[model samples]
Target: MTTVKVKLTHKNYDVKIEKGLHQAIGEQVRSVWQPRKVVLITDSNVGPLYLSSAQGQLEKAGFEVLPVEVPAGEASKSLTKVGEIISQMAQAGFTRQDGVISLGGGMVGDLSGVVASLYMRGIAFIQIATSLTAQVDSSVGGKTAVNLGETKNIAGTFYQPDLVLVDSDYLDTLTDRDLVEGYGEVAKTSALEGQDFFNFTGKIRSVQDIRDHAPELSERSIAYKAKVVMGDEKEAGQRQFLNFGHTFGHAIELLSHGSLRHGEAVAIGMVTVTRVFEAEGISPEGLTQALIDRLQAVGLPISSDLVGTPLFFQHMINDKKNRGGVINMVALAQVGQPIIVPKPLDEIRSMI
Candidate 1:
């Protein structure tokens, strides 16, 4: 097992990564938590596969486990769902002394973490990130959220988890689309980390390639992210680089009305933004094509049909990065050097 400790000013936690770690869920939680009631929050898709084993493990470890399964997908990341889960926990007589066990991918982790934070002013929660995206990105950052209207993660908080257990075994059951969707984050991180990491990810051409490299991939991304989050937990500064591909990506995603996955949209966002910046002489001339090639190598989309359209930029107007009518767009001077430039909304619109 490999462990990455996220040392934060407010708190510190460990992200344990290993295959077959799923079997140790109960024992692992027990090591960090006392015997108490826990709401095992999962989604419809993941519940049938791993919830019982996870619940049984927690139960065996002396936790009074109450299983709450929500319908799976992006729609589940909503205030309505958050309210429903909170109501369920309240009805179950849950308290801050209790905890939450998020069992699934990014959506489940995000939704579960939001509920745990809101319940009784906050409670302990652990993330068992099952998907490639969650394991590498969302699970480690302590950023929890739900979507409001068409915006992605517009509603969220930085509520750190007690622990994070990433077991790659659960990824075996994912569809090829689901598996490839995760590489979007891997690709985004590779870009932020620079040439070597970008070259490393460029070699990933198939699902088998991702599986072969999952451990190292998860470790490297999480490690880099932990370092970044430790320095800027609230996205006040350098941490904004992590949103390299997110601005345009989030807009394209909303425009698609959930047709595109988050990472898929990000893949497009990375390419789109880099091109716009390159055209404006902000990024290196060849950066966009390089991103296109690498992202395409992993079967990820590099451009969205909705892009360059009015609605696409319209969606971005609501981006969290907007301040005083200017968008703090993350641009790359090169593969390794990302900078945030506050561009006017009208200037961004000119790219279309």
Candidate 2:
């Protein structure tokens, strides 16, 4: 088992990563949180697979568990779902002392975190990140959110979890497409982490390679994020690097409707935005192609027809990362060096 500690100004927590760690969820939770009634949130797809075992473990560890299941997918990340979960917790007689345990993937983790943050103002929550995306990116860093309408992660908060447990064993059941979606985020992180990690990720040409290096990938991604979060928790400065592909990615993601997964859109965003900056001579010549090679090596898409359209132009202007009237896009001077470049709305439209 490897533990990464996230130290913040108001709170600090540990992200624990290991194989088969799912089997010991109860003991791990008991070690950190006092005994209390906990709400275990899962989804349709994952409930049948591991919900019973997770509930049993938590029960054995002396926690009173209420298993709440929701539909599985991106659509579940909404205010309507958040309201329903909060209503369930209220009916169960939960308080700030009691906590929430997210037992599924990123959707469950993000949804549960938002619930925990809003319940009685705020309560404790544990992240048992099951999916690759959850384990690598969303489960750490304390950014809890739900998509508002078509805008992704529009309603959210920076609520840190009490503890995070990432079990790679849970990823074994994921579909090939799901693994590819997650590799998008992994590739993004590796690109921002510099040459050593990027080179390591460049060798991963298949899903089997990801399965082989799950623990190492999870550990390194969490460790790098912990370092960045410690320096800038609220995204006022350095933390924005984590949004390497997100600015334009979020725009294209909205435009893609349901066809594109978040990581897939981010894969496209990284390459597309890099291409624009490269043409402007801001980013180096090879940066865009490098991203394309690394992303395609893992079967992640690097471009989309939806990009450069009128709708795409409007969406980019409305991105949450933009401040005032300036559209801020994350650009790489090279691997490991990310910069935020602001552009005029007309300038952005011209690029499209």
lDDT of 1 by residue, 1-352 (tens): 8999999988889999999999999999998999999999899999999999999988998999999999988899999999998898889998879999899999999999999999999999899999999999999888999999878898999899989998889889999889889989998898888788888987887778998899889998998899899999998999999999898888888888878998999999988888888998999988888888877876888877898788877777788998877999899988878899898888887875
Per-residue C-alpha lDDT of model 2 across residues 1-352, encoded as one tens digit per residue? 8999999999989999989898899889999998999999999989999999999999999999999999998899999999998998899899879999999888999999999999999998899998899999999988998998777888999999989999999989998778778888888898888899999988887778989998999998889989999999999998989998887788888888878888899999888888988999988998888878878877888889888888887786667876776777788888888888888777777885
Cα displacement (angstroms), candidate 1, residue 254, comes to 1.2
Poorest 10 consecutive residues of model 2 by lDDT?
316-325
Each model's lDDT: 0.90, 0.88
TM-score of 2: 0.97
- Per-candidate RMSD vs. true structure? 1.1, 1.1
Residue 74 local lDDT, model 1: 88
Residue 33, candidate 2: Cα error in Å is 0.7
Off by over 4 Å in 2: none
Q: Which pairs, if any, clash in model 2? A: none
lDDT of 2 at 140: 91
